[model samples]
Target: MQRRGFLKLGVGAAVVIGVAGAGVALIKPGLVDGKLGPGARDVMRAAAQAVLYDLLPPPGAARDAALALQLDRLDAFIASLPAPTRKELSDALGLLATAAGRFALVGLSRPWAEATVYEVHEALNAMRVSTSNTRQQIYHALRDLNVVAFFNSPDNWRSVGYPGPVQIP
Candidate 1:
């Protein structure tokens, strides 16, 4: 009888706590948040790829030369990093490159959204860090890159503080 009573009391307490938490979440609009669906992930990947590609110098008769130059610069920088840090940076860069490559193969069905971007930020944080400069540069690159790629596009310009031209014809 005593054990049964204690179990019921415990269950009741748990139910109460659960209900209280739900109530708090309802009362505080920002207390609880949602996550990105798979669709958002695909969009983010596509947007990231587009942003990088757009930032790259245009391919012309100089295409090979430009690529070689960029590769050499990146290789030298990677080599200068400490061994472990280099490996981590390499891994992160490789992952991003892979994603970018995949994006080029099949364009996204939808546009990138803010919720999905949170996942990107989380992944970057997990990837690796070398020097403070590397960290800052990467962070700035990713943040700026994504913002310009996703939010600065024609469809998103208004939300991103872009004022379209006022032309008098």
Candidate 2:
């Protein structure tokens, strides 16, 4: 083939492959639902519980309610991200939910839901201070998401001494 024709063919092939890959990513179950899958959701919940231990209410109705609210907010946050970002977070959460990933990422061999609060804290600290920028980013992302979701709620504002925004009559 002529050089110009060969270059055009290569570019066309690249575009086809990129479109196909994007289509596959868009069809992933989590993306379709606009939220993490059950296992990933569980992992996120555990991470939030651990990171927000001091801030969250004691285990009971209040805590459950707060967690549910936070999870909803977290889901919405994830959904609002760009497609590539949402996919990256979904992949990360899926990895964290597995025993192997837990061991590798957090130095724990158990599932995230079964990890003790101290263990979770250790894992998060490890990620936060990890030399890998990816690990640190993951730690900060989850921590920030949980804090923002929890504090954004009016019910929790009292705990933070944040009165509702003043209304200008």
In order of listing, the candidates' clash counts read 0, 0
Which residue pairs in model 2 clash with each other?
none
- Model 2 TM-score, all chains together: 0.74
TM-score of each: 0.29, 0.74
lDDT string for model 1 (36-84, tens) is 1233233334335333445434546553353344333334443555766
lDDT of 2 by residue, 1-169 (tens): 8999999998998677546544543443333366878767777788889888988889899888877878898887777779888777766665565554556556776777778778888889999899978678878877887887777678778877889899999
Worst 10 residues of 2 by lDDT: 23-32
Candidate with top TM-score is 2
Pairs of colliding residues, candidate 1: none
Residue 119 CA displacement from its true place in model 2, Å: 1.1
